[model samples]
Target: MHDPHSERMSSTEQRAAAGLAAVFAFRMLGMFMVLPVLATYGQDLAGATPLLIGLAIGAYGLTQAALQIPFGMLSDRIGRLPVIYFGLLVFAFGAGLAACADSIWGVIAGRVLQGAGAISAAVMALLSDLTREQHRTKAMATIGMSIGLSFAVAMVVGPLLTRAFGLAGLFWATAAMALLGILIVAVLVPRPPRALATREAGVAPQALGPTLRHPDLLRLDFGIAALHAILMASFVALPLALVEQGGLPKEEHWWVYLSALLVGFFAMIPFIIYGEKKRQMKRMLLGAVSVLLLCELFFWQFGGSLRALVIGNVVFFAAFNLLEASLPSLISKVAPAGGKGTAMGVYSTSQFLGAALGGLLGGWLFQQGGVDAVFLGCALLAALWLAFAATMREPPYVTSLRLALSPAALQEPGLVERLKAVPGVADAVVVAEEAAVYVKVDKLQVDRTTLERLVEPAPAC
Candidate 1:
């Protein structure tokens, strides 16, 4: 049987995937840069408070979540490049506006605008457009890695940049990066080849609805949203907790971030390997969610101590990495083939929206009930995710088969029926016009020799 995951990506597809991943990382870097320093920076702005600062930091996610799918669908209508160009322009404008802002409210407005770019969904859809069915997961994984790397780098760099040049200066630099991204999309990225581009029209709308309604998909979507919300919310709380509660200096917070990230990165490797290689994805995901839930509870209990908080951070990051890596892969496996883009579009939107909501709610919770409230809230969200995740069925391993057949054979009566009789063929769709057969089969049960024989040319009469 053919192995879909083993299929090699063409050079062009690799380039497109790499380019888009870089673009995504660049944009995300700008967003994450403010997380570590937002509270201190807020003090410099007019009408700044802890609650408002959290909102300002998180406002981008709210807008991005809301707009991600709309932008993605727009890409489908106009073209990917046009939508990407528009998003970059919006991002640049938002960054520039924030750079010039003198008040916390002004920064909040800027963040909201920044989120309005919502280019992630569009970029992902474009990636799917550029890659073949078999190679799409690898492309998506590349993008996922960029996101994780961007966040890690931003945490280390955000504080250093704030110390060197202040928050406004950082915003100005982000604006420059956004402008550069626009130029890259316009000039560096090649347009999709004609054959690949034409297939967009054949993608049906029904696939979108089913994916959105899927219980498993919704669970994963909610998981992403909650994960980001907790992340953003934690940043809102962590810096203050470290400085005020833990006696750590503001300038030295980067050390804490650096350590947590290093530990999280290395710790996540084994679990990720087990999930992908051992086929224990569901079990691993559940374990991670359980860990997150327990971590939140521990944070609620032992948040007063610096060491406790540090240990909590370690656990949180480990779970975060696992969930981040696994969620999209799960979506790819479960999403209908034709509407994979739409499914991801919805998933991305939820993720951003969750980040925004987490910020808003976390800020409000901090104001109303202090650090305990935020942890309790996060714990509750994680519990819900864990429960939902537990109910999800394990997705089977999928493999796609491509067969070359003669037009004469396809035209012959009962040809399709003959092909269907081959052992271990779960589903077969013959596109005679393309001289290809698309087959879904159980990799363990299917025999390659048997399949080849079924499609072999007939002997001379």
Candidate 2:
């Protein structure tokens, strides 16, 4: 019998979840900590063009985007811990290299290496291995919230750390954090249960094609890409604008970041509630995009005033938070049966690619014109994204459920049809090799008794 909501994680599961979330914090904060101070400190590096500086900020994303899927797939071949250990080593080395870097290009190279340590998919897969199915969502949510908190902390900490110890010191600190992460994985995280060896917790090559082909998923992918790119590009110009135009000192940048983030987080609460309670996610998404566009327009027009800068950031952060929180939910709702991981993998890739491009373009525009050019570039991207978002239809009000089946049931004639014929099952995918059925069901219309019988054991002769 499925426990559903009654499920409680074991002690081992809770420890594994928290430890893994810490690993994500270390990795993500390392990347995010440089965003606030890079434009200013990077100016001193050799051959530093605004474009090259921007690339250094976002280079990690490019490499991360390229490698995450393959890295996850590789973890399936080797043990998850070994792959993670190796990735952490790579990340630490990258951070150390950046710490010693003398040129913008060198920093860019180090950032690329930092991204090459792609371990997110592997980490999530390991989390799945360590938890029960009913508890997996909670475990994942823990990690998700950890990543969000890490970003917030980084925004506040980055400027202060850079002021105290320079850019290299920040990189060195990140290297140390990576080593700490390695220790966490080794000592605190438990090995996966034996069932994980053959489980479909990691990516399957077959799921890639269908996930890519889905038009609705493609729109969300593009949406994430645009969002991150604009975010990266905005920051490229934002810090310098606050310093030069707004007259805020570099050390005080944390005030802007912390305040904006706090405001945005609170401001987004109602929208999130509405998104869930009213099922108006599509409306919320479009509104958020429009808010982003308007924020960029404001920055472009009145970026010089300190007050205007604060207002722009607060509004920008609010929209950013809303979209960030909404996107994964939208992806979950839209992905086809048995293909959510694959869909998310593509979505993550899109996001990183956006970051890389956004940084590079923002820099180029700044070089060609000035701070205003970067704002204009961001505005243009937001406009296009808003249009793309307009085309997205409301997602189905269905939930995906996984059911384990006996092999005999897999071979039974009309099994797929029988599952589909169950009230409110819109789609059924039976992966015969896995002896499982992945069903998309509208719970409001589904008959619970009929659904329960599909997964019941066969009667003895």
Candidate 3:
């Protein structure tokens, strides 16, 4: 018999994880490639203004926020691949439109269309369908890492690519990359064994209200919104400052981004290790937010010096990366038993909305009071976030688990209670329809063998 507790991912599972991660990387890289260069090159476009440039930068988030849940639901109805294909095609079309556009308004229209694709949910659902319960978390983490890597790479690559090909050329590259993503999904990803009735990873409609209403979850949602808002707003000003005030040529912006991202990524690792190992997540989170607020102030005061810009950026990203990595893990921990998917959905929507608002506000501030106003505005946002984060209690340090149930065990009326009684299982939810139990367990204390034995059927007599 196969070991239920085995951590080894099957070869097929490896292929699925790798293929999906690539899809995520390609799509994210495409979207993020414009971030560092747009504020500078975008000015040359017809009808360009700081406000319009910001709108163009953030327009995609509005569409992505609106459509992601619906697309996830649609994938359940029709099929995962169909939804994925459609989203990618739409994204490609949008990129092509932006690539050919001569005006900022047209670019904004293209960005909205790009976000309309909203394939993230479908891609995740497909991953859930393909992977075994034992290794699903690992698979999801792989995809998450790919996304973060893509964002960092985009920061460094955006400037180089923009200098070589201009803003329109960058859009064209994204369009090509989207098309490449479609091919990767078709050729490389393995088909699932069957379509399961319950998607443990996909959003659960009934859980949405509770997920949103939970006070801690609400704090997390607000935190992500503030985080992304700050990111979008800051980008709107950073490029402009580097070129206009810091006396750095636009083409050389890549080295600054490259150096800062490398420093930030390495600096963030130890904080994550300490926070998780020591269970000091709340303290870590609060500290990161405080540092973010200070970074904005640093920019507001001494941004004209190129040296200060580099140092401030490196520090800002370290905090930003730490918070970005922590928030989702915190969401998984704080979400109600069996409501993780819904909680994440709400959190994602909040994040995108924050990004949209950030771009708009950042542009408006820059227009009104130059880059200094943009930094000041971001500082105020960071301060508000720090206040909100300060009230959050420590998150329960538990890992989420999904266990497949035997047919006989599925008939047990007290399944949830029995599972809950197991040592180290903090919470349990049995989805009888799916013949599975989702549990949050404290690994250090959990008796895995006993829990599995209880869930397994009795031997034949």
Say which candidate scores most in lDDT. Answer: 3
* Alpha-carbon TM-score of each model against the true structure: 0.86, 0.95, 0.97
> In order, what lDDT does every prediction score?
0.78, 0.87, 0.90
Q: What tens-digit string does per-residue lDDT give for candidate 2 at 254-351?
A: 99999999999999999999987788999999999999999999999988888999999999999998998889888878888887778878988999
Better of 1 and 2 by lDDT: 2
Tell me the tens digit of each residue's lDDT in model 3 across 246-289.
Answer: 89999999999999999999999999999999999999999999
Candidate achieving higher TM-score, 1 or 2? 2
After superposition, the stretches of candidate 3 with alpha carbons farther than 4 Å from their true spots are 1-5, 197-199, 457-461
TM-score attained by model 2 = 0.95
Order the candidate numbers by TM-score, best to worst.
3, 2, 1
Candidate 1, 5-30: lDDT as tens digits = 44577776888888888899889999
* Clash counts for all predictions: 0, 0, 0
Cα error, residue 193 of model 2, in Å, equals: 2.3
Find the 10 residues in a row with the least total lDDT in model 3: 192-201
lDDT ranking from best to worst?
3, 2, 1
